[model samples]
Target: MGAAFITPGEIIENSSNLTPGKGTIEHEGKIIAMVQGNVIIDSKSNTVSVKNDDEMPTPKVGDYLIGVVDRLGEKAATIKIIQIEGDGRSILPEHQYADIYVAGIVDRFLPAPVDAMRRRDLVRVKVTETNPVLKVNTRDDENCGVLSALCPQCGEDLYAKPEGDKNVHCPQCDYSGYRVLSNGFGQGYNLEKNGAAAYNRLKQRWSKEFDEIFKAGIPARSVLLRADHRFDGRKITRPNFEGSGGNNQRKERPKGTKLFVGGLARSIDTEKLKEIFSKHGDVIDAIVMTDKETGNSRGFGFVTYSGKASAEVAIKELHKFDLNGRKITVNNADDKSSSKREKKPSGKKIFVGGLDWNVNEKQLEKLFSKYCKVIEVSIPLNRDTGKSRGFGFVTASEDSADKAIKALDGFELNGRKIGVRESENKSKQKNNKNQRSTRELQARREEGIED
Candidate 1:
C-alpha cells in the first residue's frame, strides 16, 4: 500500500498492536502523528510513525536569546526573537515570537512594561518556557536586558547614566528615563571589563519627581521646538513688535457706515450682498456670515459703506425691505450698544404667538402702536426659508402691555387668532451684557477705535 501523507494530530493507527515511533505519540491506544510527513507502517516492528525531511531549531529552556521589542501593552510586551544565543541556526517560523511580561522585566516592581523597554529596542533575554508559548525574562541575568535603546521623548541615542534617577539619559534633550539595562549598554560596552556591577545598581524606588511626572502623564515633545536650532539653513524669524506686518491692527479710516443685515437668504454670498447694497452707496466691504462647517449662510451679515450718510439712508429705505421674495431687517451695526448707553428703552416685552406667516414687523408694530408707543418689534424668521416663525415679541409700557394682551390675546389677524401675554423672558438689555457678540464689540471699542 502507498504511504499516506499525514499531518500533526492525525490518527495513524487505531489499535495498540502498532507501537508509536519517532514523530508520533500514543494517546488512548491510538498512534497520532506529531509532524507533517508521509506515514510509515513498519509491519516487521509493528510500529507507525510520521517524519519530515526539514525541521528548524527551536529555543530550549535556560537558553539566552537576542530579539527586538515588537509591541508594548500595559501589562506585557511582545518580542520578535531573531537568534538563539551561541546558536547560528535559524528558529522555526512558528517559534520566532516571544513575550516578556511586566513582572519579568526587572526584580523591582514596575508599573508597566514600557517603564523598562520600548518598541524597536534591541534586547537580550533568557528563555523561561517554550512548550505552549515562548516566554523570556529580562531580570534573570544582568547581561540579559536592553542592549540598545532610543529616548522616548526625543529620538536620540540613550546613554547609561547610573548617577541620575534613571539608568539612561539623552544627551541632546537632557531627558532622563529608566530601562532594564544590560551590562553592555550604549556604544557596545565590554561586559567582561564592566563586570555586570552597573546592572545591579538599580534605584531602590522611584524618586518623588519621577513619580509625580509619571502620575501626571508623559509630556509630549514636538520637532518644531528644536527645528530652528537643528536646521540652520532654514530659520524662521518672528516679529519683534506687537501689531507688526499689519496683523493685529485694522486699517484706520473715518467712522464709515456699518449695517447689520439679518434674514438673508441661504443662497446669498458676499458678491450678491455687495451687488444689492451698492445702489445705496459706495460699498467699502460686504460680508455674508456663514457657518464654519457646511459653509452655508448664517442668515445675517455686515456691510460697510464709505460714508455714514449712505449708511443712514440704507437703514431708512431697507429696513423691512423685501429682496429675494423675503422681508429683511436692517439696523446700524453699532446702534445696539449706543442706544443702551444713550437711553435705555423703558417697557415690558410682550410675547405674541399664532402669528400668520404673512404677518411682519410693520404689522406687529402697528397693532401694538395703537395701545401705547411701541419701543421695538421683533419677528424672528426661519433662517432657511426666511419666513416668520408664527411668533414675535413687542416692547411696550407696562400698563399698555396689559391692555394689548387683553385686547389681542385672541384677536384674529389675517386668519389666525394670536396669543399674547407678558413675556417671561427677562430684559434683553441686561442679558446683552453677557452675550458673546456684545463682549467682542466691547473689546473692539476698548482697542481705541471710534464708533
Candidate 2:
C-alpha cells in the first residue's frame, strides 16, 4: 500500500530524518514510515489512507457567513456570498455558494444585522437557491454586487422606483440612488443617494404605528373606577335641619330662622359662608349672590340655620365678624307694620316716600317684581297740577306686601332715604280723640252735681 504524505500535527515518534519521502521512524509515540505513493497511516487506530493535497473551497450551507447586502428589494434581499471555507473536492463545490438570494426582507420585520439576537425576538430565515460559480472577466466587475437599501431617514423598509431618467428613487422618502454595493447579508444594498429621506419616512411610520398600538390597549374606564374606589365605605350623618326631635323643641316657627351674616368680605364664597355658620349650628343653606357675568362677590348674603337658637348664636358671633377686610351686619329680619305688611288690604293704602320723580308705576313694578306682584303704584297727584309728587303707593297681596316692606325698608333709591309706614285714616283718628275728650268733660259735670 502507498503511504500518505503527513501534514503538520501528525503524531510521529523516535524518527530522526522526518522528511516528505523518508523511511520508517518513531518520533513521539506514533510511527512515521515512507510509503510508495500518497497515503495516510493512523498508527494509533491502525488505519491507512491516501493523501489528497487539493485545498477545500470555502462556501457551505448551515455555516455562518459574512456578506454585504447588495440589492435590497421589496420582496427579497439579494446577497452576493463572497468568501467560503471548505474542501476543494466536496460533492457541493464551494464556488457554487456565491450570489445567494434571500426573499421578503421588506415585508417581514427583522432586526438590523448589527443587533445581537435576543430571546424575545424571532429570527426567521429560508435559503432559496445557490447560484453556479462563473468565471469573471474583470476584478472591477466583481465589485458590482447587490446592496440593501436601509432608510437613511427612519430606518424602515424602503421601496425602489425609477427616477426621471437614469436614477432610482426610494418610494418611501423620495431618495434617489444609482450606485450599488454589497450589504452585510451579501445581497441587500443601500442606494447611493436619498438614503436620508428614506430613513425619515421609515421613522415616521414606525412612530405612528407605535402610538396607535399604545393607545389602543389603554382602558378608558380605569381612571373613573380608581377615583370612585378612593372614597368607598365613607359615610356621613347630620340632623335634619327642619325636622322636630323632642318636646323641648320650640314650637316650629311659622317662619324659618333667617340668618344675617355681615362680616364677610366680598371675597368670601358660599362655601366659606356655610362653614362659618356651621360652627354655631347646622345651617340649612348659605347663598352668596354674585354678578353672573362678572363673577364678583356681592357685599351681602343670607344663611338659614337649622333652628332659632343656632340662628341667634350665628347672628351674635358673626354680626360683627371681620371677613375679607370688612365688618358685616348680622341680625334678625324685622317685621313690617300690619297695614303696610298686608299684601291684600280691605281699604288700607300705604304711602311710599323718597321716590325719584322720573320713577313710574312700571319702574316700581319691575323693582318689586322679585318679592311680590304690585297691583298698583299710585302717585298722589295734586288737583292743581297733573305732575307726580315724587312718591307712590305699591299695593300687593298681604303676604307679599310684608315681604316687600321688609326687603325695601332700608334700601336706597335715587340717593334718598325711603320710608314705609302703616297707612291710617286721619279724620277717623281725630274724631275718636275729640269724642273721648267730650265724654271725660261730661263725667266731671255729673260728679259735681252729685257732690
Candidate 3:
C-alpha cells in the first residue's frame, strides 16, 4: 500500500480498519501521532483512518534527499528539505513545512572555515541514520540528522584535527581558513554528482505545473507537433549559388581621370558610385549634381581622387566605361581660371574657358560684377584677326577673385558648362622673354652682327 498519514490515540484495529481516537491522528507510514484528542471521523471529508499494523517507513541517517540551501553560518550551513522521495513519509504535508539539519551540509569541520558553504547552495547527501530525539516533532530544530560531509575545497572527507589545531587547509588550493561547521563532520559541503540532477527534476516539475495552471487553454500540443514537422521539412531547401551574378557582373574600380558619369540611369546614386570607384584606391569625395526643383540627377556628376596620379589612372581606365548603358566621360577636373585665382591667397591672373563665342571682356565684367568688383576682364585677342577668343583672363584682388571664382565656376550661361583655372604667370613670362630674344636676333642678323 502507498504510505499514509495517521494520528495518535486512534485505535488501528487492523491494517485496513481504524477506531476514532480521543484526538486527531496524523500518520506517516505506520507511525501515528496524536495531533488533537476526541477524534471524530467525517465520511464526507477527505481524511481517512488507518490500521495499527500498517508499516511506517522511517528516515534514517545517510539518506540522500533533495533540499534547498537556507542559511550559511561561519562554521556551518543549513538546508531545508521540501520534498522527501523514498519509503519514509513526512509528518506534515510537503507544502506546509520544511526539514533543516547541519549534518547534511559541508560544515562538519572547523570554526569558520574559509570558503564555507552558503545559502541557496543545493546539495545531495546520503542519510546514515536519524536522530531519534530530534525526529519526535515536525519542527525546524527537530529534523537534524547526520550525513556524509564533502569538503568544498578538496573532494576529500573532512577529518577531525588534533587537539589545539587552529586551522584547516586544503592541499588542492592550499586554502587555509576557519572551519564552518564544528559539530557533525568538518567545514565545507561536498556537492554530490546527483546534486544537479535533483535541481533539474525540481525545476521540470515546477515548470510543468506552472504551465498547466497558466496555459491550460492554449493549444500547446498542436503547436509542438507543428514545430517538429517544420524542423523536419527544413532539410529539403537547397541554397541558391547561381542567384548571385557572375564575377563579370561585379563592379569594377574607377581609374585614371575623374569621370563625369552623366546620364546615370536614375537608379544609380552615391552608393553605386562608391561601389564603382572604391577599387581605384579611396574616393576622396563624390558629388552628383541634382536639379533642386525636381530632386533628380542633372545628368552629370564628379568624383575626386586622393592624388593626381590616381586621377590620371582613373581617366585612362574608366573614361568610356559603360555604366547602366551610358557612355561616361572621364577627364581631369576642369580647371576653372576663376577657381585657381580664388585658390591663391595673393592677387593673380585667372584663366577662364568654355565661354560663349560672343562673350568678350565687357560681357565678362558685367557677369562677374554681381560677385565682386572686377579690376579687369581681358579676353585674349587673336593676333591674326584681332577678335576676342572664346576664353579670357580675369585679374582681381585676392579676396574678390576667390569670391568671383566660387560664384561663377558652376554658374550657367547660354546653357554651357564653363571651366575656370589659375594661369601660370611664370610660364607666360618665359614665353614673352623668348619672343623678345627672337626679335632681337632677327634685327642683329639683318645688321650683320652676332647676338
Candidate 4:
C-alpha cells in the first residue's frame, strides 16, 4: 500500500509497537501525527514516520548533534541539542532535550562526570545508540567534542596556555582548566538570544513535556538527546595561509576573528580594505557593505582574521587610523553585549554631607546646579529654631554631584569649612556611626591604661 494520508491528532501508531518519528507527537499512550503528511512505517526500525511532499530533514541514528552543555549530573548531562550538524538550519520544531549517561559519553575513563564536560561548552556528538532512549558518543572522536568552551572562573573564552598538556587559559583572566577540545577550539562564545534560549529550555522538564516525549513514549527524533556519550579550550593566533580560501568561509566566521569596520569611503573596495587591514594581521576574509541589488559599497565593511588576537591587533592599529584620508572605526563584530556592559555608569545617586548650618535647599541647589541637573535638594532643620541642622543633603545627577563636591567642599561656606561627598542612606549612616563609636570607646580605654 502507498503511504497513508494522516492528519494532526490522528493516532497513526501504537506505543507498544512502532516508535514515533517525524511529524509525530506522543500523547495519552498513542503516537499521533502532528503534521498533514503521509505516514510511512520503517520495518527495520519499526518506527512510524510522516513524510511530507517536500523533503523534510529528519534526524536519524548516527546523526551528529551540536549544542551547548546544559546541566551536569552525577553520570549524565542534560544536553539542549539545537541542531544536527548536517541540518542546514540551527532551528528545530521546538527546543529539544537529550540526556546522556556517563558511559555513553567517551571511551576513556572519566573520574568524575564534570571531567567530561563543563557548562556552556559547545559540543558535537554522534548518536551511537538509539531506541526508546537516544544515546550519543563524544568519546574517541578525534575531530569532534568541545568546539567552544570558557574559563570557569571568568567566563572568557580560553586560549591554549603558553605551554601545557592540552590545557586552555583564559585570555582576560588568569585561570585555566582541563578541556576536551575539538579540531577548532578557542573560538569565542556566541552569547546570542537563540543560544541562551537553547540552554534555558532545560530549566525544567515539565509534566506536559514529559508526556510529550520522555515520560511515556518513544523520544521524538525532532527533540531527541541521548546521553551515554563520553564528553569532554584555547586560543592560538594561527596564521592565515593554511586555511585562507574563500569569501563563503567568512560566513562561518568564528567569534573573535570577525571585525566590524565602519566609516569606510564609498569608493573603497573589499580588496583595498583587506589590504589595508592585512598589515596588522592576517585577513581571512573581507566584505565591503554593498547594495543588495546594485552591489555598490555601503561605506562600511567587515574584515575577519584567522584568530581573535589577530583581529584585536588589527582593530587597535586601524581604529580611527586615517585610511586613505578617512579615519575608519574597527571593532569586534560580535562585541555588542560586551560594549553595552562596558559603558560608564551615569546618573548614580550620591550622598552629600558636612553642610553648614546656614545651608538651605535653595542654596544647595544653586551651588550644585552649575555641575549637573539638580533633581532634588533637602535641608534637615532644627524644629525649635527652624534653622538648618549641622548637616543636610543634596541630590543631583551623578556628574553634577561629583562636580559640586569638588568645587564647593571646604570652601569656608558660611564661616564653616563644609565637607561634601557620597551620602550613606540613613540606616547605613546609623550603623556606621555605631561602629565608629565602638572603635573610639575601645581606643579611649587603651589610652587610659597607657597614661
Best by lDDT: 1
lDDT of 4 by residue, 153-233 (tens): 546666644232235666775555445555445443332322212221222233342232222222121111232221221
Error of 1 at 55 (Å): 4.9
- TM-scores for every predicted model: 0.39, 0.20, 0.20, 0.33
Distance (Å) between predicted and true CA of 183, model 3? 24
For all candidates, what are the clash counts? 0, 65, 58, 21
Off by over 4 Å in 2: 1-255, 334-451
- After superposing candidate 3 on the true structure, give the runs of residues whose Cα lies further than 4 Å from its correct spot: 1-57, 74-76, 85-109, 132-451
Q: Write candidate 1's Cα lDDT for 137-160 as tens digits.
A: 987578878888776555677787
lDDT per residue as tens, model 3, 292-372: 446665556778786777766776677656666444666556654564322333465677888877676667888877877
After superposition, the stretches of candidate 1 with alpha carbons farther than 4 Å from their true spots are: 1-55, 187-190, 193-200, 217-451
Worst 10 residues of 1 by lDDT: 217-226
46 Cα displacement, candidate 3 (Å): 22
Model 2, 1-451: lDDT tens digits are 4443655345444334222223233446455433223555556555544354554344433443334343332223334344432222332223432332221222212222111111111112222233454221101122222234343333333343433211234354443432222122122332233332232222112334333422432122122223222333332222232333222133444356775554355667888888877899977767776654466655567777768888878876876565543447787654345653324434335567888766666677787777776666556543223445777787776667777777877678777767765455578878786444546778978888432
Q: Which stretches of candidate 4 lie over 4 Å from their true place?
A: 1-22, 26-33, 36-51, 89-95, 104-108, 162-166, 187-451
lDDT of candidate 4 at residue 384, scale 0 to 100:
34
